[model samples]
Target chain A: MILTDLRGRYQFGFGRFMERDYDDIPGTYPLDSRTYRKGYHVNMFLMSLNDAECRDKFAEDEQAYLDTFRMTEDQKSAVLDRRFLDLLKLGANVYYAFKLISFDRQPPQVMYGQMAEPRLTFDEFQQMMIDGGRPIDGNRSVEEWKDG
Target chain B: MAKLIAGMGTSHVPGLGAAMDNGKTQEPYWKQLFEGLEPLRAWHRANTPDVNIIVYNDHATEFSLDSYSTFTVGVGENFEPADEGWGPRQVPSMSGYPDLAWHIVESAMAEEFDLAVHASMDLDHGFTVPLSIAYGQPKEWPAAVVPVCVNVIQHPLPTALRCYKLGQAIGRAVASFPEQINVGIWGTGGLSHQLGGERVGVVNPEFDQKFLDNLSRDPLANTRISHTEFMREAGCEGVEMIMWNVMRGALEDDVDEVFRLYHIPVSATAYGAIILENK
Candidate 1:
């Protein structure tokens, strides 16, 4: 009786604001909803690493393996070249990209190093993190932090 | 009838897991943030609930880009931690409340909220790290968990309003359960820190504080926030704040801010934690 008498109520402050579009940041590939839709094939193909059989097949014949999935020529090239940024631009999420990195037996810092301007070696990237993460002030956005 | 007793939110920064796993709580870098979790420790010490409906996003550890479900409830018997390249954390398996999970799914679906069902899936730090923070490295989780996985990693996350409404539906579902049980809702992730791009360590304490104030004072107003604003003002990945709405929406309109924590530089993230009890 007490439960029924006391009903739950949620306050939703109904209002309006100019909903903004997510398309400003330069040199950054946002894994936003649209990107997910556009890069669906490429991302799913990478996701297949969860299965040992697929991983074995990819190890044997990279192109023949990629052919099984209908990815774009650009995505095919990005994966072929082990281009982390290229894959990111083509719609691969960092976490899913980890599978690809692990397949290459490389640490994730390799991908991090790949993203930075004037790309550093895997060792340089690891040392930088140890020294202190890439300072946020100068690397915020291409528009805000022009020097980066 | 089942009753909703508490709602809380926190970040699932994998580094926090590393800290706890490696026992670096007293280090200068981690000392303050580790101290922030004392309130949760105290709360659990006393008023521990029987079950926690953990609402967290999967970080590509399990559900990869292939089959990402917007909202999924784990109705399996137990959830074991994942290997995730590095070996699994030394923690006991988490017990799942299948009866409650299935009930919530049915109730949520009946209310017109499409929720996916999962019998088995490896949970990553997003789910496990918060467990470590709240329950410590206990032999077992202090309470049974009904894992509710939300897809925040993929772009085009559910609108803040939709997350709030989904929480409301989950609250109703929990309340309508025939079995009587004390349930706590936990939403984990995000307090304004971006991991990717040039903006690697953007810790917006100002934005983080306002988020805490509003989440504590008036979450209703929070639902009106747009995803673009969260990404821009908060950070590219800061939009993960939507998961908190699910936690807040599960509570009664009246709640008390029992405890809250906010710290920065938790490995490229501004970690945040909060506890809200039905007042």
Candidate 2:
């Protein structure tokens, strides 16, 4: 069923930007209308990090700063935990979630590492990237990986 | 009349911008990438345009998700570099070419392409990194700019074909301008590197190289590459390559491909750069 939902997102576009279910693509979280609607508040909170004053406040009291936004409990927890993939599942766009990463002065690779399948440490992620990146073979779709 | 002399396509990875600002271009990690770009820098020195039309996407830095516009052009006289969490990079503010910008906007609208015009836009890495790569750390950029922002963040992004057609309209708009000026259009970002979900370190060199070839030789075919294929083959973020179509569409059908560079995993992206001039 989850696979169907992912696959459906990409199924219905008429050579234009129509809403389609694309969950079957596996390992990709496209910011469709559904995710956009769900993750709006969390993303808004993330976007706030663009301002210096907001960054100072966020750095001063992380929880209190996050509490000001009307994000869901899952969104808040995911953000607080630095659970990047969970934040995405909770509707946080990676670009917005990146604001939080940027605020912490961590390179984006840290978040990329955390978001990797089987999760990589920063060093492992860098090494994988150096080794010509994760191969697209067997990684295209859920069914491809399953069959492989 | 102003002539469209060249078009460029390159990845505008934020890390590349950071590398330039921090004087880390020669660091072991970034040395190869910088070395690959020397030819491009030399090319820029030889044929610097009077004005550059930069087509890029804002990454929720300058504009929040609260209200994101699909297609926007900057008409402001100057644009400040946006502070994307880390303090804004210490780069010179870009001078906006209002006359040319307004001309393109009016001409595009007249041609039935609806475009949002912003008098104020904080230029992000998507806008600045390309300049840095081409011109290095200049006190002020040699060329004035017209920023064309595309929506790649939210869903319902403008299709590849739509972006291409818009570029053609912009090309007509630029050519019709009465000033004797040289103009360069650049499409920045992408070359496959997914940053989200379980596919973080993905970079398809095969797809990235082929994309460059098709973009140079068979761009109309690229206009038909669906969003699904971009995600499935090039990674989700690879969809950003649609903006490159805008640069291609603005140039003549047959272009002289002068310089091309393809490198893997600058941070997480397969950095691809090309300079094409209309033949």
Candidate 3:
């Protein structure tokens, strides 16, 4: 029943709440109000890394630090595994999640590379960007692709 | 009365700050982008403004996600660089103009723009990288600064029309100040590039160029663009282009476009910059 409802919303645009509910946009996630509420604790945990003390504690013991926040087990595991895309799925704001990337001593390109559809290496992602970032032709909207 | 002399916009990508801090600006990968900044650097050197009101967004550095503000005007006398997970960048502290800042806040409030007045706030890459790009690494920043931070990170950010109106209010605020100082308004961020999701590395040059062109030729064109449209064409983060409308709205409808530059892949960003002087 839940799956049917979800598919119904996608097909008929019934469950739409805000602009973000429009599934017609391809490969885009706007940190909408719902996502903001859901990601609050996780983002708070990530935002805490801004402090030197929090950074030290988090570096010393990742699990213990993550425990300070009331995050879902999946969110915690995503952070632990450096699964950036999964963290996004679990409602991690990209700006907040960037603190985690910095803690790992990686440039943003590395994280962006990991988030790509096929999962590119940093070099591959950099090359793709130089060659002119993912073309806007078929990428703009999922609806446009269907129309084509 | 204080005069609004110039309005400018640029991408405040953190990687540009990283390159400058690590002395990589001249390296092959960074050389062209840095070289493109020479004209803007020269423009600043030739015509220095007494104060710079910079419009930038905090990326979860000083403000946490718990209770983020929609708009914040920095009214402090001094600001330190924020430590964004990593240690703070080795940059000199900045001087803030409380007198001018408070005036702007008051005037804006009088104009019915409900801006959160902040007495103290740390400067992040979003605020400082543009400074680095324009002024280089000065031991002491050349001009006093007043930071106007918008919350672009959270969803349901201020609409393009709203931000533009805020800029118009700020422009009036700066003009009403008692001092005879010259002021520069800068809106930093965006030229198409998403930082997250499977569509992370998207960059639409056509969309970005149209944005740059419309900023002067058809300033209201940008004000009419919806956030959804920005996301569709420019990428999710491309919605940041709305900030540039603030700079454009602050300027006279007709102004001199002093310098403009655009480049691709500034660390997953389509780097764009413009300097416009009020006639």
For model 1 chain B, where is the 10-residue window of minimal lDDT?
B194-203
Query: Against the true structure, what is each candidate's TM-score?
Result: 0.82, 0.95, 0.95
TM-score of 3: 0.95
Could you tell me which 10 consecutive residues in candidate 3 chain A have the lowest summed lDDT?
A: A14-23
> Candidate 2 on B1-279: residue-level lDDT in tens?
999999999999999988998899899999988998999999999999999999999998877667878899999999999998788889999999999999999999999998999998898899999999999999999999999999987877899999999999999999999999999999999989788999777888888888899988998988998888888888899999999999999999999999999998788898999999998
Error at B82, model 2, angstroms? 0.3
Give me the runs in candidate 3 sitting further than 4 Å from their true place.
A1-22, A144-148
lDDT measured at residue B213 in model 1 versus the true structure, 0 to 100 = 87
**Tens digit of lDDT per residue, candidate 2, span A114-135?**
9898899999999999999999
* lDDT measured at residue A77 in model 3 versus the true structure, 0 to 100: 99
Give the distance in Å from residue A37's predicted Cα in candidate 2 to where it truly belongs. 0.8
The digit string of per-residue lDDT tens for model 1 on B67-156 reads 778999999999988766455667789999999999989989988889999988888788998899888888778899999998887765
Instruction: Put down candidate 1 lDDT per residue, A16-88, tens digits, no spaces.
Output: 2212265554345567555677678887877776556778899999999999888999999899998987788
Q: Candidate 1 at B19: error in angstroms?
A: 2.5
**Per-residue lDDT over B105-204 for candidate 3, one digit per residue giving the tens place of the 0 to 100 score:** 8999888888898877898999989889889998999999999998887876899999999989988888789999999999999989899988888889
Ranking by DockQ: 3, 2, 1
